[model samples]
Target: MQALLQEAASRLHAIEDRLTVRTQIAAAVAAMSIALVSTLAAGAAIISYRHTAALIESSVAGIASSTSARLDRFMATRRQEMKLFTELEPMQRLWQGDPTELRSALEALQRNFDFTWIGFADLNGNVVASTGGLLQGKSVAARPWFKQGLENVVVGDVHEALLLASLLTQRANNEPYRFVDIALPVRDTSGKVIGVLGGHLDWTWASNLIADVQANDGNTDTRLSILSKGGMVLVGPKRETIRYGGDELADMLKVRDGTFRETVDGQQMLTAFHVGNGYRDYQGLNWIVTAS
Candidate 1:
């Protein structure tokens, strides 16, 4: 009877050991499964985050590209028009010594275009013909437009009007008039350079153009800016200087056209930029257009 009882006890101990081993194996498999699921979830989250970031960058870049193209077209069209103006009948009458006809033509241009003033200066830099005859009989010999227009077609940078602004009605806010200069040499039928044709475009046209662009896009959150080659802010939400040398923004400028993430003037933003690729024969001004 004692031997039978000992054998039963040994069998029961063996059964208990097998059950413990199986339980541990089952627990190990469950832990491994949970770990694998967690890793997959983490990987998926990372991929989603990267994709969202890429999409935002691409969208901003697209807006910048579109704005650049529009500006190029605007500039190219104006340049082409200036070229055509040289061939107008009234302009051709210059060789006939008829400054009145040329003045009429320029006046007609002002009616159709946003010209603050347009004039044809003689070789002596005396304004012989002008829009509305405002500056006619005046000597602009010392003006940069008169000097540069003698050689070639020149697109001057924006500047405060010196004498032209005072000749006009004052703005309600008494703001100073700003102008962009465009000039080219005028030649007679003999191909001999006779004089220089120059025009001052009101800066308001540009501001209006940008406003229309932003309104059409319907994206109020996105801000666009135009910068000179040296990074001076030419047009934007606010006229503020952006330091260009030795910063990450400088590195991005070297790329000429791309997207970047950076903090500008204490605001962190994702920005897209496209450098001016001047339209056909226009030889762009190398302005940097940015959308953020």
Candidate 2:
């Protein structure tokens, strides 16, 4: 009887010892698991921080690029404005055999502006003085630009002008290269209107201007041109060749009053239009400037 009782106690003690060992093993595993989880979480946080920092740096770089581009445009515009005031102003004042003024204006308009030709037209649409080749002594009586100027009854303000055969100077190959005319009205000191002061605009220079303006901008395809309401090509004349007498032209006519943007032929175009009215010296002309 004593031996049986001792055997039963010994078995109970062994069972208790086995349970304590199992509990200790579970606790150790749980502690190790917590440490592993903590280490993984710290690694994830560090990675997230690095990603955020990289994004911030990229954003800052974009902003800096935008700022630099804007500054460049501002500088270019300022330079052009200065040239207009300092160089063009004096030339504009000279008239009637003031060869120096005419020469100065001509040089500035052609060489500096990259225009192919320069000329003056009377209120009656007579050619006064022409500088450069192939246009001297040419009669412009039948030209659309002259007729439009007569019809509109205003001059002097800059607007787009058109060209007709014999009105424009012939190119070196004798092929007529049409150009947009940037014309204003000429006036006497008494503000009496005399004629239209006009010159040719180089499309290449104009393209450069557009590229400069768009160096940092997106979402806008622009055109700078001169045209009649009837879809005549003046400046950037090639545009008319591609889109003659279509719904595209109809869309353009809708926004001739101010600077605006529209989609034509599945492309975005920003445009600014102005009709010529001579408040200074030029009077009585209907001309338009379109910048898209």
TM-score of each: 0.87, 0.40
User: Over the stretch 79-116, how does candidate 1's per-residue lDDT look in tens digits?
Assistant: 77877888766557653477777788788877887678
* Best candidate, TM-score: 1
Candidate 2: list runs displaced more than 4 Å.
Answer: 1-94, 98-105, 147-178, 209-292
lDDT of 2 by residue, 137-165 (tens): 55666765555544333212223334435
Query: On a 0 to 100 scale, what is the lDDT of residue 56 in model 2?
Result: 46
Off by over 4 Å in 1: 1-19, 94-96, 218-220, 237-242, 246-254
RMSD of each: 2.7, 11.0
Residue pairs with backbone overlap in model 1: none
